[model samples]
Target: MSAAVSTILPIEADQSKPAADPRDLLLHSIYEPDRDIQGLTARELEIIFQAYKKKDLANVPVRKAPSYSEAEQSALELWRQQVNHHMTMRISRYSMGCVSRQHKTSVSPAPRPINRTEHQVFQIPELLDLILSFAGPQVQIRAQQVSTNWRFSAISVISNPKNMETFRSLAPLPPVEYGQLLDDTTRSLPEPDSQQIEQFGLHVDHMVSWWRKLYRRRYVYFPAKLAQRDDLPNGIAQSLNELDVGQRHGDYHGSIHTVSRTTDLYWLDLSQFQINPYFDLLFSEKGRMLHRLGRWEIGLRSNATSETLVLDDSSSEKLLVQAVGSMHITNPPCRSLGIYCYDNCVFPMHGTHILLRRIRNSNGIRVAELLDALQSCAPQLLTKWVKCAEHLRRNVTETGHWVDSVWLIPGTPRFRIHLDNCDMSDEVSYATAVWTPEMARDAETLIGASLGYQAHITRTAYMSAEPPRATKEGEWLPEELFEPMKTECGRSNINWDA
Candidate 1:
């Protein structure tokens, strides 16, 4: 049989479902109702009915010519048209099958693969530079190790000092200065305003001069009493000896230890050393009367000068304040042998313009009382208190305990503020107040009694090339600060004749 005939053979019905009706199937598949079946007269229907009644209904041809006049011509026309359409569809399907078979049998040339010669990107020096520019320093460095050609490109880029500066500038930081600040020209500037000085509660010029003296000295003197603290470290002598090594080499130094960033504020950690008494406890007597020379940390906000203050040893009970600035403080090197801990305290400045304080339980003083005492001693810090009031009030109400303190020095607007909690307990509570001009006027309301106390303020100005992160040992000061002295000493030790 022909392929078309074989394709038209009846399909086997699914046993899972009911068998289809042969009569209905024959009517739809083989007969057109209007022309071949329904339009037929009674005699034609009888013939079709007899044909469907047969056992081999699948083989029966329902196509028939009606004898009636209404269907005689119409039936012939529809039969011819239906046969043409069926033949056309079969022919078209057969043609498509032939094409598909040919496609499967036919061989097509393998697709042209890309050739390296077609696009030599690496060969182009300009293109390679463009690509390398987008790559990071480490990536470029690694690429250099890959080939001599890559080495040339990387060296050309990195060896440029401007490129090095570009990488250094990626981090937003203040300019770093080391050594000392000796600007005789600045001393000749106009004197500070008298009214402004009174508002600051101290002569601004004297304060500035005192700070300059300390900055130039690169030394802080702690009182002999603080050296007597029971908690003082025994290895202070070793640390001082190490300092002497730098000093002997004429290496500039600062009391500043570590400088790092915490959010928008920059934290400056100062070292507390006793240049006088060999052994004095730092921050002894729970910070009551002790000169309490230890590590002092301060936070700096924007528009800040690089001036940093140091707590120097003064007379029996006093710690002298001195301002030190520039690169002298940021570059303290790693000491191979020195005192790890001195009789020192950690009074950190940890705020930008606002002061945050965390309250805990160990602090014997209540939050309110501490705030009151602070207000009495430094009424000038009223602005910080106002800014911290809401948080303080909320914490006090919630925990029924207070342990936060926010204090700011008066008149020293350039001096940064840090907020911290009293170290009485582990559970810390904190708050910040919004200080308005009105709040300054309302400071009297918050203070029960004015102690009329004044804290000597000194502002030191310095910037670091970059913010140093805390090391594994929690040391955040860059080691480069100590490198100059070591470098100079190494040069001095060289034997030219040898």
Candidate 2:
């Protein structure tokens, strides 16, 4: 063991021998030029190759070289530069993409503002006028609430004088310019043409407010104000084609005389006003000024059972006759006349027919007096006329048993007879007069024929009766007088005087 120890210690290998260059080893590990390295880098490939080669090479460690071969060093330098360049490019591209996305997200189009000028170009007044023309009454009022512009437009359109005229022209006659007048009063401003405000329609509250204002100004009559305010838009006098003065009760009366005098009204519906004493004022000397009148409707408060006598001495009929007759004599010749005896349920036989005949024959004087005198001259004619009378009476009945009958007779002088209370009783009998006593004899013959028709009707009624009559047909007095008159009995060619 001593001899071995002395000699074997000298067998130490050369530890100072030069080590293989690490760069050369690294190059050798990745030296395969034909090898395909896709996602893996050169360093990763080298690591993998060295890991596998390590088993075959034993535990020998590679040496660190001071420098590398030209080809190996170049390849290494190129690889490092390529990696750095790719990273830099990728960072630049990512930053550019992020900026582009942010720019797209942040950008937005500007919102447009409402153009007042464009709106004004359509002309607010014209727009409002169009709206009123196309829209109904409710829409006109509702348009005011749409916006401040709409409100202003509506007011301006209604208040403007020219626009008001257009509105009036568009209205059906008797033209109503109520909306224009209302706009003027609501703003507390004098209307542009007050004379044009002939007919007005106001809400209940608004009418009260207007009355109060007018009363404060000591306006005794609406007509005078109408004439004075000619410059006012839609004045009462100028626009006065038809006047409707509404009142809640029959006791109400208006100073319509002055208004009628100043206005050219064709129809006057004073249905809200009372008849009795107020009617006296209406048909007074001053009130008779309504010469243009074509139709008149006035309300009465009298009961059905009440006897409303319109005697020739002093009655609305006489006043109306005088008023209408005077107008007829003046030669303009009024064609149509309508009298609505509202609430006056009792129908006066003599007065109503006389009035109707007078109004009908006013233009032709030849028929006027003849018609008037016929009232007393023919008692049989009166009985025959009872049908018309009964018809007129039934019209205003509360029970609605009889309805008004209107007939339009077509001829050169066309006439319309409106029976307020029409009766359809088959039991009513009538008599008619003929030219001479001989013609009267012929009428009796016609009556005899008419009686024959009645016989059949009576026989039918007797058969249907619950308890049959004991009397035989021959035993009975024929019941001819009780039968309805022929239809011809209702027709007459005789012209009656007014």
Instruction: Give the number of the best model, judged by TM-score.
Output: 2
What RMSD, rounded to one decimal, does every model reach?
A: 41.1, 51.2
- What is the overall TM-score of model 2 with all chains considered together? 0.17
Q: Tens-digit lDDT track for model 2 on 17-78?
A: 22333333343333332333333444664564555344212212122222345654454345
1-498 per-residue lDDT for model 1 (tens digits) = 122222321335323333334443344333343333323444554555455443122222223311224443344344434433433332232233444566578896895663444247876777776677667455555555445566566555544444433112221222211111213221111343546434333322333334344312232222212221222333442232233232221112244333211111211122211111101111121221122222222211112111111112222212110111101111121001100111011111111222222222221212233222332323223234223333322332332100111111211111221111222122211222665666544442221011000100011111101111122101211233111121111011211111
Determine which window of 10 residues in candidate 1 has minimal summed lDDT.
Answer: 448-457
Q: What is each predicted model's overall lDDT from 0 to 1?
A: 0.27, 0.27
Model 2: lDDT of residue 375: 29
Candidate 1 wrong stretches, greater than 4 Å:
1-119, 166-498
Model 2 regions lying over 4 Å from their true place: 1-309, 312-332, 340-358, 361-498
